[model samples]
Target: MKPLLATLFVVWLSACGAPEPATPMTQAEAVSIEEAWIRETPPGAKVSAGYMRLVNAADAPARLIGATLAEAARAEIHTMFMQDGMMRMRQLENGLEIPARGQAALKVGGDHLMLMGLNTALTSGAQLSLQLQFADGSSTNISVPVKPAMGAADSHAHH
Candidate 1:
């Protein structure tokens, strides 16, 4: 009888007020960006590419919908593939997807971020910031360093 009374009292207290709502995870909080770098552009160059490793730590998949840079008029997600015995690059109209508990690579000669219409030139050893927007409408800003265009091959080789 006492145990039943205690259980009823607990239920009554719980019914007195809705349980505090669980805080939702924002898109930016669910994903982490790693190893971000942008290739240096030559003088008067209007475009350059950036690469990064996107790690999705959440249970659900995350999509990289867009990116923005103050130094460029616009930024876009792009991919390069073999076409007709030649390499062709195209913009990803629907953006890029990172699988749940998996990762996506924006490496050279592959899927990458393209910064077009550069109003300012990017030089080696310089740094810039870009905002990464996700499909969930949450965005994260990351600081990217500029590296010499010719110093390396696949960066993953070093690690």
Candidate 2:
């Protein structure tokens, strides 16, 4: 009887060690984004910048092919690089690649989404909607708030 009880206990422990069910990946659920925001621009400025960290949790690498925003006449992926001792920004035609299980950052003075021909001032605390297109025919709509540039000194604060 003790031998049978030990056998049953071993079987129960083995069952507990079995792997959990794998979660299905949905197009709507595959990608995750963080720290998405649009920088606050001065009044009457023609262009502003958008920044975010795009995370690809899927099994395959993903590409950000394009983006659209209602507040701007046009939106394009851009990269900033030093050329001939000058900082220059240019549109990326091929799209930004985000490796599988990795992240791509669109930050200030680096890779960013350029919003041109602004329809209105991007004031602080205002939300902006953006649609991002991916190579896998998946798209995501994100709402980002406009915030002051990071590390900008407050002018109202006295020394």
Candidate 3:
């Protein structure tokens, strides 16, 4: 039929033209991040913290293996716990995970990202750039907003 020949000719022309741009797929794309934010640091402070909620849409779990922020010289995945009636914090050697079809949150007084050795002060209403690495070997860049302190933010200040 003329219509069939026309469709075939169109397909042949498209195939002969420039190929579509190839973009490598990232396994980490199955996980989505939301509510990402960092706490504003006080003057002369060398450290700050950040949090986010992750939702995994994949059938397998997704691991957040590392993070980095240009504002800080170094970044670490950390957790807070009560020890001997004193609040203490430690780095998570293995990072964090979002269960399959579930969610995870890095929140205050809980699992968080510690940005240390700050080269500059973080003020409220400022925007920060953060990069997150996953166990699946994907690195995702996230823009985080510096949020003002909440009234309930009373806790040990980072050193």
Q: What is candidate 1's lDDT per residue for 105-134, written digit by digit as tens? A: 998878989888899889988889989999
Estimate the TM-score for candidate 1.
Answer: 0.81
Report the number of clashing residue pairs per model: 0, 0, 0
lDDT of 1 at 158: 13
- Give the clash total for candidate 2: 0
TM-score between candidate 2 and the true structure: 0.77
Q: Give me the displacement of residue 22 in model 1, in angstroms.
A: 3.5
In candidate 2, which residue ranges exceed 4 Å CA deviation? 1-28, 152-159
**Steric clash pairs (candidate 2):** none
Candidate 1's C-alpha runs over 4 A off are 1-21, 150-159
Q: For every model shown, what is its TM-score relative to the native structure?
A: 0.81, 0.77, 0.81
- lDDT tens digits, residue span 1-159, model 2: 999999999999989987988865644356787999998888987788889998888887788978898989998998877778866788889888888788899888789898888988899999988899887677889899999888752221110
Candidate 3 on 1-159: residue-level lDDT in tens?
Answer: 999999999999998999888664454687788999998988888988898999988778888989889999999998888888978899899989889889999988789888899999999999988999998789889889999766685464636
Model 3: residue 21 alpha-carbon error in angstroms = 19
Judged by whole-model lDDT over C-alpha atoms, candidate 2 comes out at: 0.82
